[model samples]
Target: MNSFEHDVAVQATNDDAQTTKVNAVERGYYEDPFVRYFARKGSRKSPLINRGTWVRVQAVYDSVDRFLEIYRESSCRQIVSLGSGFDSLYFQLQKKSLFREGDRFLDVDYDSVISKKVEIIRTNHELRTALRADLTQLTNTCGARTDQYVLAGVDLRVVEDLKRVAEKVAGFSLEAPTLVICELVLIYMEPKHSDAVLNYLSSSFTELLLFNFEQVGPEDPFGKQMTKNIEARGSPLMGLSAYPSAQSQKERFQKLNFNKVAAISMLEYYSKCAESLQDNVKLRIRVFLVLELIRMVKLVQEMLIQLFPMVAQVCKRI
Candidate 1:
């Protein structure tokens, strides 16, 4: 089966394009030149979808920021992004001065994705300078790695492959305080595969923080249609049925022996975090516009609520 990961990247790029056009930088959404290079021209997303993406990006950024705040005194800090796709969070964080010295960012994905990303990085001076990578040192299979950044390829289903990629390509340390991001990636995998990846992380990393962002609520009308639609497209949400709600997602981590786990739906996040941002007046206005758009398209709103209901969680391993 063809990996549907590229589709997700395209959607994100489209969202970034829309968010950039609307000047929503405060929401932590960025228009990556690499993404723009691959994005289809004239592609646009609905305002509500764009706002939801904005909220999602903000939630992830805030989680990472909180992690940094807690580990500011620590000598080693790292971020490992699974299936990083075309997202440029690492570069953006560096640009915003959030990433400090002695901090490492690693991005792992399928070989094809990593190859294209490396090509873009090699061609773009900004990305090359930010990563401090020597283009002469990179290959299609093994990505460029510098003091602060590492990009490598991995097949998440294989434990040995993950280990090799981490140890050989990325030189990741288990002792470092690491934040593992699995945004919108796990749902595409089989339950056993995703569970294996989670179990490996849980066992290997001593001080680990996991941030998972994905769709939930599979029993709802929207979820049913969403699953059907995606399956019809030949890309099923293989793990959704196993962890279909916020509580279930939280319990999954607790069962894996995480020290602490907290999960909340996107609606709750929007109410508490997104709407309460005092500094971003423009973001607040965009939230209102999304609500109004929701009212105008009730059916679309229902599908959006049901099919796109995202659960974000922060899990800690002590």
Candidate 2:
């Protein structure tokens, strides 16, 4: 594990607090009451992220739904959500009655966020006690779900915590295909730490993974601006060490041996459901890149040659 300083943790805690205050339903769903209220009350024409990006957010929702649908078809009804931040999907899904009583779903995150979620679920008498049981042995009758699955608080950034929490889901039969989600989280860590996460997830699951991430393109306007903003804020966390391109992402996945690799853009998903949105609201999505999680690998040698002066000289000799 990389040695993270106190400031980083403080900053992350503050950021998470601010983020959790905003409901995902509001930011993601156009028709959410908070979104409508903000639209009516705020002087700003659009949200900081914009409607176009929110349209892209639908790709996340759709991907999760697709994973559940496919896994359900295969008789594997467990869904594991990693780094689940204020996502209302669990409650929404339960409301829709999509999953059978036996279907199991678990959301993992930091303590504070999970605590908040526990309260939200506990309000529904049937959903109470979502976190009382240990996840490492969930299938041991003690953790079985009769009506709805569960939401648990566990940090994924820490490998031990991830393994401890995931053990519950991992205990299930390998024949029971699992759908693991690592959404909008890889960018939070430095490359090496991220590698650990990828390796852990890869080893934990034998079947499927639904991973979502963003790439830092050199020409991306927002990415450049965000990097500048972070630098101005006296922190360089937003700046990427290497511009993680789509090609590199795909290459890593291929190395990991994940098959049937396909790249789906957010643009395609929004286009299919364009009719549901408002006329003034444009549903623009830029998928720009994708890679299967199990097939990906990050080669440090190429990066070293390009970045280090001594390595560049050594490569030129050959």
Candidate 3:
């Protein structure tokens, strides 16, 4: 697997670890037991990192949950997750009663990553039993198709590969109201490739809600350092230059032919959506002095706003 693909597993490990904490930001619905097995030593993340992860998770979850409310009245509804590496979102949605019996949830990633994930699911009795999938038939394949969940391996740079996987494995319909998620995935790819994917999605899906979560503000020192650090680890942020700010991100989708688009930075989300969850944060950092807590929150907000800011964009096809 490439460095970027490996990074997904690392993020999953961190999410699993955070879910096990006493006052986790969101209770992990399916906190996979195999996360610790794949995680490296010292994989435990700091509270700041965990909180950031939680914010992203919560934002996406809320968006999907909102969509499902309308999806119930629609004929066909599907969720397509790009570069979905060991994320338990499908399971989580099922637990939350958001995933219906006939709805399709497709998780696409590299062949190597999907193979490992399928093996993990096969060996884990809880995951296997929950999906009602046959463990014996899941081996030696880059893709696995269950009743509701479809895990496929495809190179995201190739638009044809995505179309083929969706048809053959996921049985995804273009006319269906679909939620397309590209979380921290496109920034790692070249701008042309990312653009091609976005253009394809806009043209292919009639009723679509596309959400992209990625780092913005690449002109700043913190963004430069974050880019350099990832490059040092052999995964460069190639698309950051194409959409370095929140406005640029919103415009990117507009130019791609999405009818409606809105982008919000992590700082704005914290100022708005996070108020409801502040009590959990307070409990987790209770040991800190009052001044320290205030200072830390401000520091985190400033860092998120100026430095490694994350932008969440919602784009809809008319």
Candidate 4:
């Protein structure tokens, strides 16, 4: 099927009567096995698109675990996942016992989107009942403890509601550490929203940030292609504006007075955990120019030239 046709076909399957086929628990952009299975079920004409979809899924999740690790290490009891979609962070943390007695977990997502998820979690015996049982046992096995857990539906783009919940949960004191994960959400907004978010996080939260972003500047070939594919899939590319070049990203944090700033290419992050990735999964990460703007940029530039000799020729010509 053509791209639009494929999207239509996917949408058709979401009709009221047809919806009974999937059940409450499995309804998400990525949750449906068939959508994923077939979306990756490639044809000769669009192998790249299929592979890219798989890569996108893998990249998002790969980063998720990494973000979770940061959360675990922050030693913060309170955890907030901004723009938490079908993210399994809370479930994973619960299973791993990453939070202590005073730690609180809150998931902020759009009301409509989260309502569906909440319904699924509420109705599905597995997520609420079976999965919890399984995780509770695992938590016991791992000795990971938590004081409290809560999932509140809020729009991250709307600062008022998000701030209210944050204040209520963590309070304005900022005495205890709070880990806030914005993940891939900010990119959907204009740069102004991103600026506000960065400033808010820096001021309101204490200690540590795990930010994952993309760059869509005119200079990037892969980025251009990636944006085309995203829109082709019939999903709004709202977050495209949020990605910035390495220098721009560095300046953003610096503007907000972030105490310690370290930047890593998505490629570097993937490489750091390469040994741990599963065999069935394939990961392709490129942050070509973005990484070039980090501390000691010249050194990383020299290394990139060594690793990608062809790029060096292209750069010299440019």
Local distance difference test values of all predictions, in order? 0.68, 0.46, 0.68, 0.45
Candidate 3: Cα lDDT at 54 = 59
Best by TM-score: 1
The better-scoring model by lDDT among 2 and 3 is 3
Please give each candidate's TM-score: 0.82, 0.64, 0.81, 0.59
Q: In candidate 2, how many Å is residue 296 off?
A: 36
Sequence-dependent TM-score of model 3: 0.81
Clashing pairs in 1: none
lDDT of 2 by residue, 1-318 (tens): 223442344235434322432333333334332222211232222232333335545555566676677667665566677766556556556556666645667777666665555554444444433233322323322222323355555555577766665555434433355566655555555566656666665555566554544434434554456556645544454314542555565555555445434443344444466666555443321111111111111221111112100000000111
List residue ranges in candidate 2 displaced over 4 A: 1-48, 123-148, 169-173, 230-239, 264-318
lDDT of 3 by residue, 165-272 (tens): 876557888878888888778887889988998888888777888878888876677677767776665566778888788788877878888877777777787668
Model 2 lowest lDDT segment of ten: 308-317
Residue 116 deviation, candidate 1, in Å? 0.3
Cα RMSD (angstroms) for every candidate in the order listed:
4.4, 11.7, 4.6, 12.8
lDDT string for model 4 (1-318, tens) is: 354553343233223112331221132212333322112222222222222233334454554455456456544455566666555556655565644555666666555445554555555554564235321111111111123544455545566666776666434335444555655455555567656766666766555444444443423555566567655655434544444455555656677667655555544543565566553322221232232232444443322221100000000111
> What lDDT is obtained when candidate 1 is compared to the true structure?
0.68
